[model samples]
Target: MKYQFPENFWWGSAASGPQTEGAADVDGRKPSIWDYWYEIEPGRFFNGVGPKNTSNFYYQYKEDIALMKETGHNSFRTSIQWSRLIPDGIGEVNPKAVEFYNNVIDEMLKQGVEPFMNLYHFDMPLSMQEKGGFESREVIEAYVTFAETCFKLFGDRVKYWFTFNEPIVPVEAGYLYDMHYPNVVDFKRAAQVAFGTTLAHAKAVKAYHALNLDGKIGIILNLTPSYPRSQNPADLRAAHIADLFFNRSFLDPVTRGEFPSDLVEILRERDFLPNYEPEDLEIIKENTVDILGVNYYQPRRVKAKENMPHPDAPFMPEHLFDNYEMPFRKMNPYRGWEIYEQAIYDIAINLRDNYGNIPFFISENGMGVEGEERYRNSDGFIEDTYRIEFIESHLKWLHKAIAEGANCHGYHLWTFMDCWSWANAYKNRYGFVEVNLDENYKRTVKASGKWFKTLTSQNGF
Candidate 1:
């Protein structure tokens, strides 16, 4: 094979609890922020569909895992819902949730698939959210407890664990912007939320290490390389600041065990410092992730801002930089995100050169195209030629990175099947298997799925 991956490289896809599991009101599962937000305003969701109207993984996990095997998934990643596991996110463990999760794990293992479990995936229990979610110390403690419970319960069977998936999304969506629940546009609150989540991650890693479980714990971070529009000093500075806020804020503290000094200085100057205890810094410093999960989808290209922000306006990350769109750049027009496959290689090199060459994987990377159904071919499967090309291009760059000594171990797509997103709902589909919502959520393997089977069977394309 011209492009073969390392032996034992992970091959599969990822999906979160809230996005895939549809039993929003069953089996001792309480309301997550998504569920509660949907109840309050259903129209905010796509076609008025809520989390309850997902792919129904709660009932069809067995069938889905079988499909995963058929699609050449030697390993798979999914999150155990905090609300389902602990109805209140803090107290007694639900026996039903334990049974359900154990069954899922066993089934995957039975089908020769390694189960990678993530503790949290942006599904904060409403009870916890009522108490300020990640913005409050109480919530942070509750999250740490949740992580510990998961470790104690499933650590033996599930050897791979992640504390959180894209923890920065909540900071950006809920605190910085109004895309998610408890939407408050406050930079100070965003900082606090981000700080608390990272601390929670470190605390969870500490707890996992205490258990001495034969597993690795880490965090999934979306690393979008910040590209400057020009070589000008101001433009470079703008990109640097953007990276500081979005990438280094979580990457440094989680992996390097320290927040970026440049970012801390800016936060201090603006009085936007998070309310962190002195001991919390020590916890973060002492406990860093064992592995890293890099999720790359798009790059952030920015130019220096042409106009200064008005003093009266609320603080925003974009105030310092203007988004730049390079001419002749490939684009994912369906999602309105640029498609720069080379950014994946850059991320691998950056991690290898600067982050101690830590073992990592492509945790979440896939193309989300709208109107995928229109591509259904004579074989009754979506052709998805573009999706196949997207994966192949990214994998080519990934192979190049691996050849150069990047310690990336695997490539998992964004999802196992198309499922609900937070606000976008089912607007964009990113899956190897196309899920038919109208036909009792029937699963059909797309052309990409067939290609992936061959890729994994041969260890690469």
Candidate 2:
């Protein structure tokens, strides 16, 4: 039951700009899509706690980097708000935003904690969304410009760069599901948005390598392994379809420089294929990532849809494949996601063999538990045994994958400080360090925090 990581393995945590930074309208920072969406649809978020009231890490990053070091992080991944850099998403670089980010990045370097910075994480400058967000090819060009600016500004010191974080989710939540901003349920627009994003990522990667930046660049994708109900051919094929849409849609394009034939065929069959140019394929092929970040939280258990709806029903992803809960599968009640640790190994090995063994990291994986305070002891520590088990179980599998020649270099959990989820808000906590919501930002290291420190120091739990 014991496991050890490679001697130089990276132990860290990951967070996004909008998720943690709270000064929504300060320091010459313009509103992002999250801020704009919350103002109009306050009811959309859980408990009405929008992006403005997260962890206050914007002003407390120095204190936070200290906490990261304390939690055994030699490296930490966070993002720079694009709106802060370009208030209008096009021209006029904001000096205050630059100054604030310089301070944060410098502080991270000072503490010997490598800062893996991402350019965008579901937070588009509100100005760009007005011009049709990813729908407009003009928006794609603007993103490349913003990306180049970031590299010129921070590429000297910060090495690790991610172009986007889970790009597919927005296309689903915003365009298809109506759960995120610019909510619209249209397949055509969703397909267009997804293609634009793929092109945008390729363009950014192209730009990064042109600048000849100091470090590696990659995309952070949420790759959930899809499982079939049984060996039945129908169930197996259904799982394959789900994986193509959710996992390979972005994965294949970015890592392999080509989209899957199965997915393209589906889109073609339904007349949902997005517009594409000949030059785009060359860009994607030439500018593939030097690294990858795989965010695995749970596995998808799928079965064929029980009933075929009328062909006219609005097409959602769920229409393609139905979710069926296995009678005996383990579950995380608070989070509503299944627990399948071995899937991590499956992901690692699959990438190794299929994606040419690109260097990768566990980008985002965590347990979100409600009312975590109940476990806090009088001595000011939370006995998060569940978190420890969840992590160890996954690592056991990850170790096996590494031994089998998977090119995994690191593991960064969902977050360091307790923060707000888009819809869940602060209702569920996933931080190793707990943040006090009622009072000033006071942080206490939970049992998981202490446990992680030990794991990193010893290179194992």
Candidate 3:
């Protein structure tokens, strides 16, 4: 094989309980923020579809695990919905939820697929949100308790654990942009939420280690490399600030146990620093991650701010940098996201040189097409040659990075099957297996799925 990966490299895909498991209100599973938000404002989601109409993994884990093996997945990543497990967020456990997750894990093991369990994936219980979500120190402690409970319940069988997936997303989506629940658009509150989430992650890491479990615990971060349009000092500075806000804010603390000094100084100068006890800093400093999960989709093309906002306007990251559209850049026509394969290699090199060469993997990387059925052939399988090309191009760069000693361990696509995304809600299809929504959500392996099985069997393409 020309593009060979390391031996025993993890080849799988990732999904989340809230996104895949469809029993939103069944078996003691309470409403998550996604459910509550959809209830009040269904029009915000695509086609007015809500969280209730997911892929139904809750009722079909056995079949799903079988499909996972058929698609050549040696390992898989999925999150444990906090709302489903605890329901009330900080009290008695849900027996049904425990049984459901236990069965899912056991079935994966039975099928020879390793399970990489993540504790949280943007699925906050409604009760926790009512208590100020991650913004409140009380809620942070509650999240830690939930993490500890998960460890006690499922630690022995699950060898890979993650504290959170894309911890910065809620801070940006919910607090800054109003894309998620509680829709607050205050920069100060967003800063508080981000800080509190880091504190919660540290507490969870502390709790996991205190139990002396044999598993590795880490946090998944979506690290978009910031590329300046021009190397001018101003443009470079703008890119630096963008990186500080989006990437380094979570990456540095989880790996290095501290925030970037430049970011801290900038926030301090603006009087936008989040409220934190002195002890909180100690916890963050003491407990860092054991590994890392990097989810790279594209690079950020930025330039210096062209026109300043009104002096009295609310603060935002855009005030310091402006997004620049690089001419002739590759893009995913359906999703409107840039297709930058080399960004994966850039991220690996950055981690190798700057972040202490910590072991990491591509936790989430895949294309989301708007209408994939158009590519279906007469034989019923979607050809999806573009999807295969997308993965192949990215893997070539990843192979180069690993050959140069980048310390990358695995590559897991963003999803295993076509799942119901949060707000997009199946607007884009991104899976090797097609989920026929019109046909009782039937599962059919696509052309790319067959190709993947061969790739995994050979350990390369």
Cα RMSD (angstroms) for every candidate in the order listed: 0.9, 1.0, 0.8
Better of 1 and 2 by lDDT: 1
Model 1 residue 377 CA deviation (Å) reads 1.1
Candidate 2 colliding pairs:
none
lDDT of 1 by residue, 363-399 (tens): 9999999999899999899999998899999999999
Model 1 residue runs over 4 Å out of place are none
How well does candidate 2 score on lDDT at residue 134? Answer: 91
- Residue 450, model 3: lDDT of 90
Superior by TM-score: candidate 2 or candidate 3: 3
For each candidate in the order shown, give its overall lDDT on alpha carbons. Answer: 0.93, 0.90, 0.93
Query: What's the TM-score of every candidate structure?
Result: 0.99, 0.98, 0.99
Residue 93 displacement in candidate 3 (angstroms): 0.4
Model 2, C-alpha of 446: deviation from truth (Å): 0.8
TM-score of 3: 0.99
Cα error, residue 268 of model 1, in Å, equals: 0.8
